[model samples]
Target: MDIKQLKFLIALDETRHFGQAATRCHITQPTLSMRLRNLEEELGLPLVRRGQRFEGFTAEGERILAWARSLMAAHDGLYAEASACRGQLVGTLRLGLVPLGGFEPMRLLSLFRRQHPNLRFQLFALSSEQILEGLTRNQLDLGLSYLDRLAREQFDSLELADTRMGLLYDQRHFSFTQTSLNWEQLGSLPLGLLSSGMHFRQSIDHAFRSRGLIAQPLLESDSVHNLLQAVSAGLCCAVMPLNGGLEVGNPHLRLLPIAEAHTLAPLGLILRRSAPRSALAEACFEEARRALADELRLSADR
Candidate 1:
């Protein structure tokens, strides 16, 4: 019936127990129960399925919970905007980033922090698919991931980096005179790569297939750092982008460019096409765009 009741519903969903949800809302169990009953009566629909324990929400309850979440999100967004107009930004920005984006997300966050010191951020390392789903579900305000990885989703994206996959290895362990490598040559190396479930790995696999070669990774991990560590320890060579990676400035690991790699894709910032963009989200997006432009400029200079 009211935001208070909606808050109670969210707490109930989270705790899945009447007593615990009531405690979280700082209300008595019976009062919480009464409020829930009133809410169901107002809606003229059976929301909660009551039993010996806190049964899960009924079909209508689930639908109401979805709207509750969205209403709460927009409500928070409005308050944040109001604060921003008063010359302060105070809110938690939920950001989902693919591991491939590396520290770019952090770097972007760092830049935003300089301007809006009061705003906090919650960053999640996710796959491109997960990022897309998170955006649709209103779980994430923004995402840093491959623009092309998402299919059948309405998304607005700003390309953040022109990243390319390359061979990462300690130069001391390899015999490569040239900086760029041919795709066919990768078939002979003991490689450390991402798992097949990851879009990054899928892109690499597709590239190998196009070259009539099968990628046989000696070490497969979902974490980019794991693959990088494998390469660092001279365990195997890794194919990946050097941007925002630990090896970028490391003297020992040489990022051998894949001269004609098809695995490389434009990494970017994405928002749900129809979702409302908060002021903080817009500010961060602009900062990200600036950072990407600087990166591209530096790459050109190099």
Candidate 2:
């Protein structure tokens, strides 16, 4: 019925326990219960099923919760836009990113802060699946992930960069006499790969399958940093993206590009189709586009 009621409903849905939900909302349990009861009375439909413990919501309650989330999201967006209209870009911008995408939030944050010094930015490193879920739940304003994996109807995206996959190894463990490796050459090595849930790993799997080859990684990780560490320790060679490649600048590590035509993946920025964009979001988007373009041009020149 009201913003407060909607907030309570969303909190309850997320926590699934009245006590935990009340704690999240910074309210007492009795107050939360009374509010939900009042809401149900007004709607003439029982929302949450009664139980000694936390039970799931009823059918009508589920529908109400869904609408509540959208309403709250729009209301929050309106507040952010109104604040931006006063010549100040001041609001929290929540972003979800795949760990291997090589997005350095600090660099972008530095530039963004110079333009809108009052803006707040929250960054979350998430797997591709988590990023997609966050976008659908209205928990993340934007996501950095593989463009090919996103559903076109539910979201919109802009291609940011081509993430080139390569093999990284400790020179102490293996010598890179060749400039690049074909899929067959890579298949011969004990490699570390991203977890199967990540788009990067999926891309690698597809490349192998298309060539009638099997990729059996010796190690698997969700974090790019961990994979780099493994390569530095001479555990195994790794298949990783160019952005992540920049982090493994150790003298011990050698990076060799994958020469197969299908190894490249495009990294992109995704956002909900109906979510409102704040001035800060617009500035961040423009900066990413510009940075990606510059990087592409430099790569072409080289």
Candidate 3:
């Protein structure tokens, strides 16, 4: 009946343990149990299916939990709006981004912050899969990642651009005639790429396989920065999106476009389709759209 009780229900569902849920809410075990019992009595139905401890929610409890999440999301949105009316939007905007997203998020965050200076941001460099997962759990407000691999039913996305892959290498270690190379050409060269666990690596593998080739890299790293560093030290060449931060400007470093492997991966902003987004989120999403369009235009002019 109350938002506090609804929060308790959501905590229990998220943790799947009574003691932990109570601990999260900073309440005693008996008090948490008694409060839930009181809630059930008021609603005239059992919420949790109990055994010795917390098992799971009943059918009705599951339905209520769904509503609880939606309501909680809306409540947060309302608070943001109220704050906005007072001349500032004060809240944390969490972002989960694939390493390939590069400096685009900073651009978006800067534009948004100019208008709402009080809004704070937290950025996490995550894999494409982790970004989508965080959106579902309400842990992330938005994601800058590859949209091709995400399920259509679960997320709403904006395709920012077709991020063409690039070869970042040091001329001291490997010499190439052309400024741009092909996928088949990469198989023959010493390479360091993202680990296979990342979706970006999977996309690279798929591109190689489609051309009757296999990915044989000299080094594998989960962090994009590490892979780029390996290439910088003349250890190997790295294959990644032609975005900012990856191509270190140096006489020895070369940022070459990958040819025939014209497999263009879509990079975008993704958010949960079912959840109620905050006002700050809505405004930032619009800013992201504009920023992407401007970037595309600049790329075209180049």
Q: Pick the candidate with the highest TM-score.
A: 2
lDDT of 3 by residue, 205-273 (tens): 888988999999999998877887798788888887776555555677878888754333678888777
C-alpha lDDT of all candidate models, in order: 0.81, 0.79, 0.80
lDDT of 2: 0.79
State residue 220's C-alpha deviation in candidate 2, in Å.
2.9
Worst lDDT run of 10 residues, candidate 3, spans 259-268
Candidate 1 RMSD to the real structure: 4.6
Better of 2 and 3 by lDDT: 3
Superposed model 3: Cα runs more than 4 Å off: 1-72, 150-154, 249-252, 262-264, 290-302
Candidate order, lDDT descending: 1, 3, 2
lDDT, candidate 2, 139-160, per-residue tens = 6888888777779998878776
Per model, state how many residue pairs clash: 0, 0, 0
TM-score of each: 0.76, 0.77, 0.72
Worst 10 residues of 1 by lDDT: 99-108
Clashes of 1: 0
- Per-model RMSD to reference: 4.6, 3.8, 4.9
Report the C-alpha lDDT of model 1 over 1-302, residue by residue, as the tens digit. 68999889988986999999999999999999999999999999999999988989999999998888778778778988898899888899889988765335667788888878988988888988888987876768898888776653587788766666778889778779876888899999999988887767887898898879999989999887788778878899988765657576678987777876644577878877665657677767777777778888998999
